[model samples]
Target: MSLNKETIRVMNVNIYCEYNISEKPPLILIHGYLSSTYTFHRIMSKLSENYSVIAIDLPGFGRSEKSKSFRYSFENYAQLIKEVMDYFHITRVTLVGHSMGGQVSLNVAKFYPEKVSKLILLNSSGYLKRANQLLILSSYLPFFHRYVHYHINKHDVKEELKKVLFNHSLITDEMMEEYKRPLLEKDFPHSLIRLLRHREGDLSSQDLNQIYTPALLIWGKQDEVVPFKVGQKLASELPNANLIAYDQAGHLITEEKPVEVVEQILKFA
Candidate 1:
């Protein structure tokens, strides 16, 4: 598929996105924290064959603007997504979100049900509380962003990738390069601090129940980041949902099992 890349101004922030033309309802792919549209590269081409796939880099991550002024909460992110749909003249979409992106997708489905046709979450972060009080308090410190940069700078990209992927063999130089790309930006750390301070806790069970949209929850049984049990809980709480587990997969199920992920998305959406 020929992917078209563009940067559109939404809500005063320049948002970066990649899309392929198709006649079917669009598929909006949202990546996890510290990730970009690259996370969905494996499935983008194939998925675009059936649906117009629009993969985005949420503010503060990927190629999108890392504005210090942008509200880094899920609600704001959901609103930005809605504006994106309007920009593209898309009426409805199948939201495919992974990890933090999944939480953002949940927010969209919960608040803008009319704009969503289906919801698919991959090892999505759910029912988690916000940052600890101590961390929130420290965020007020003038130089806290530098500390955040220091902490993240200390970790090797390859090791970090290992923590998210069950199949370490998939780790390649290209993967490390893409994962580390955002870290090179001087403004990224500041935006991350703003995110930690502004991000609210995940949606509660009451909130999830309100969303009656058809949902599919795909979990990586070996996922240590967001355990498979979370998926089980989500399935139980989401009024209309189905849960599928891949025993050999980890948090980065999109990378580990893209073929199966596409199959499930096609069957469900």
Candidate 2:
């Protein structure tokens, strides 16, 4: 399928954000790590009718290409997003992020609380960083990325990808194709490495008591990436946050349970 209509001029990055521009209460959708705005395709279609759904493929992912040596830390990602929002003249908007995207969204909320009207994190990563330290250390290993390069052609990374998605049965063949298509393009893996290495851990935890923006935390009962129990700690820490756990779901809660997610977001938004 051609993704022609999903184009949007945001900052210097001509990002891929899909939405019905006429709708009210603009909402921005952010995808997880190693993923793209395509993750929200189905959700956006259903939401665009009543709300302006803007799903962006972050600077290093999907359609937006960054120059060589661009650092992909959570702070930089948050800044890029802020620039995009500013370019569009968005004052107060609802921010929804999944996994790594959730980390970025929370940082945006903490740093630019005035700009974000509400924060929605779907199985976010900030709640647990020590657990991800092993991946961070491995990404820094000498020639570790070479394995990723060699495996890309061998088509052996599906298992790792499955781990990220929590081995969900809802991951259809078509969805797998969509997830893997971007990696087929040259230079995608290098960008992925850059993002993984530079990402700063959860900024929300530094001063969790400061966040006054009404926040909603959603997680899957079976989420392997960020366990459901972590959401309880986050809810307890974030000043005004609430948690909603979806039974029988995995890491990709919004993707796996779009209706429930949309309903909760609408209630909070």
Runs with alpha carbons beyond 4 Å of true place in candidate 2: 1-14, 128-145, 151-169
The candidate that achieves the highest lDDT relative to the unseen native structure: 1
Using alpha carbons, what is the TM-score of model 2?
0.85
Judged by lDDT against the true structure, how good is candidate 2? 0.75
Per-residue lDDT of 1-269 in model 1, one digit per residue for the tens? 78999998999998999998568878999999999999999999999889988999999999999998999999999998899899888989889999999999999998899999999999999999999989999989998888999988999999999999999999999999999999989999988998998899999999999999999999899999999999999999999999999988999999999999999999998
TM-score of each: 0.98, 0.85
Candidate 2, 28: how far from true, in Å? 0.5
* Cα lDDT tens digits for candidate 2, 36-108: 8877776777677667767788876777674346678777777877877776677778898988888788878
In angstroms, give how far residue 177 of model 1 lies from its true place: 0.2
Query: How many angstroms is residue 180 displaced in model 2 relative to the true structure, after the best TM-score fit?
Result: 0.6
